[model samples]
Target: MEAAIAVLVAQFKAFAGADGSTDTLSKGEFQNLVTSQLPNLVKNSADPAVIEQLMSSLDQNDDGELTFLEFWQLVGRLANQHGGFSR
Candidate 1:
């Protein structure tokens, strides 16, 4: 579980920027990150053209980058869909 969390965090950081802090991302930056890193999930996203289209729906802030809560919500949803961690 810890390892999975770390991998998720690292992936988020990669998208979020070298600063790797959620606070550092602009809406555009966050969208780019999702497009590149979350291709599997976001490729089929309802609005595939702009990353912000999907992110804005999920983010709810219209501010762009996801807050930690938003990020965790995404991960949790995905994990539930995918059956979460395995032994």
Candidate 2:
């Protein structure tokens, strides 16, 4: 569990730091992260508009960027879906 959490944080930091901001993920960075790291888990990995829509949904503050907390919402949802915990 600890390692999984650590990996999540590390992945978030790795992607978030692409634009020199480890605190938030820009649209481009988020797209890259999803298409590259989560291609199998995230649907429409090849569609730019889908990515944009996803980013919009995750951008809680409407700042065009996703904070770690916002990113975690995605991770949690994915985990739930992958684990068959979502109804």
Q: Please name the candidate that would achieve the greatest lDDT relative to the true structure.
A: 2
Off by over 4 Å in 2: none
lDDT of 2 by residue, 31-87 (tens): 999999999999997799998888888888899999999998898889999999998
- Global lDDT of each model? 0.63, 0.91
User: What would you estimate as the lDDT of candidate 1?
Assistant: 0.63
lDDT of 1 by residue, 1-87 (tens): 899878877767666675546554556666666666666765554354555565665786656567756777666765576674533
Candidate that scores best on TM-score: 2
As a TM-score, model 1 comes out at 0.61
